[model samples]
Target: MADSVRSPRERYREQVRDEVKRHAWEQIASAGVTALSLNAIAKEMGMSGPALYRYFASRDELITALIRDAYRSLADTVRAAAEGGTTAVALAGVIRGWALQDPHRYLLIYGTPVPGYHAPEDITAISDELLAVLLVVCADPAAEDQKSPFDVLLGAKRGWVAKVLASPRTVHRALSFWTRVQGVLSLELAGHFAPMGIDPGLLLAEEVAEL
Candidate 1:
């Protein structure tokens, strides 16, 4: 399983896949995910459309690969922060930093849903990892146990809520953290705040600290 023991053919396959993904990302950035075309990527890579299909059978497959990579990178980043004893505000900053580092990556997952493309279950599991980390840092025994109406509603309806083994209040806090942070990032990335000249980072800090 060591890198030194991998066969040349395996290495070549991985290299090709990586190269194809690079081209796909370029296409996603230039146009949009809905406009991503395997044939276009193939032409860019100097390969026939059929040849590219061998690497990624369809556009959805290529998209799934990219989404998986993006989610994995984020899950790892947040998990690392949680393990380092990050506070709620610090963790919000971590998420904001990751999103700012790559707006396209952030928007790809959170900006808008790709029509006719449903994320596979494994992708859901990776996202669950993100929520799990949020729950860890959002836990506060000293806080009041008061639950709002939405918290009760989320607990009753959201299947993942009970599985995470946290109270509805904790779940509510985590969800609020996610939504507020993402709201700031979405607006900032879309140039909504540029004219206002407000700092998104400070705005994000205030939002998380208030939680």
Candidate 2:
């Protein structure tokens, strides 16, 4: 089915929403999400705080939208790379590029949880979507029989195996790849490597190569 065309008012609203999100990200980058203020944002944009509420019902609603966009962006990035026949290492490189381009956006999803903020179920659903992609990238069509202790454990869980249809080996590799990348990225982005005088990029590249 084709996408329905938007009316002029709808288009304007969408544009403003994007702009609002951009400013929200900047604010979060500087003072953290706990300090995100719709009124402050409004003041900066020269609009009344109540007027902004027309677009977002509450602060939590806006934060939820930001989280959704972050997850969606990462999911789309990985899916595109995988669909283009990229390998795990190459895909990891793409992820690193995405994170480097907007470190705050990357952290917004994976970094420390916002105080007093609990994500909704849709956030978990988007996360599962991302995991499904990793399962796809990890699968080896010719090597179905390979398994490890963890793979055996995962295989016994019929609920998920029945859904993702990935072999234990694929799942193991995918999880290992995910953890390694996350470990490197979280530390690197947190500025832990700067004090050590070691290159985080080379470390990340080496880890990917090992995988």
Candidate 3:
């Protein structure tokens, strides 16, 4: 990697870029991404408005970087867990802790999208990496195929999962795992469960335990 043999200028550029992203995250934490502003970031960083453009050309570009980073972090964490032989339930706990530690970062990836803001291909690819890790974690490689109603639907869309998991049932399980955890997590992080007397973690563990 070029970073392995970085020159001074390249290192400096990387530092400045990281600082810009840090400020962007702070802004996101204070307000939503809709409130993000390059000009405002420039003012905070003590750099001219135009100078900030050297690092990120546009607001969308910065959002892309942040999204990519968030997805990459989750992917890397999942991969590490898989390598460490973590169980699916434990992996779910890892994800829960990560999201709770930084709810804004969690929402940045899984939160509602801004209208008309289509993510770039690279972002989608990184997202698929996260899914791939989930597949590996959730795959019941030794289990026999079990056809459900959704199996037919998922088989029709086996364009990606078929390559990683040999069993259709396993693919369906992985899908269920992702959707179920995400459903519970989104609400928990959004404070939807605060009004309820029950613990959200118990609810989440129950869902994952069933998986």
RMSD of each: 1.4, 2.4, 1.8
Model 2 RMSD in angstroms:
2.4
Cα lDDT tens digits, model 3, 84-189, are 9987788888888889988999999899996657789988788777777777777775654567877777677756756665466777787788888899899998
Report the alpha-carbon TM-score of model 3 versus the true structure.
0.92
Best by TM-score: 1
- CA lDDT of every candidate: 0.89, 0.85, 0.84
Q: Could you give the candidate ranking by lDDT, starting with the highest? A: 1, 2, 3
Error of 2 at 150 (Å): 1.7
On TM-score, the stronger of 2 and 3 is 3
> How many residue pairs clash in all the candidates, one count each?
0, 0, 0
- Of the two candidates 1 and 2, the one with more favorable TM-score, higher being better, is 1
**For residue 138, what is the lDDT in candidate 1?**
86
Candidate 1 residue-wise lDDT, 150-207, digit = tens: 8878778756676888988888898899989988889989999999989989999999
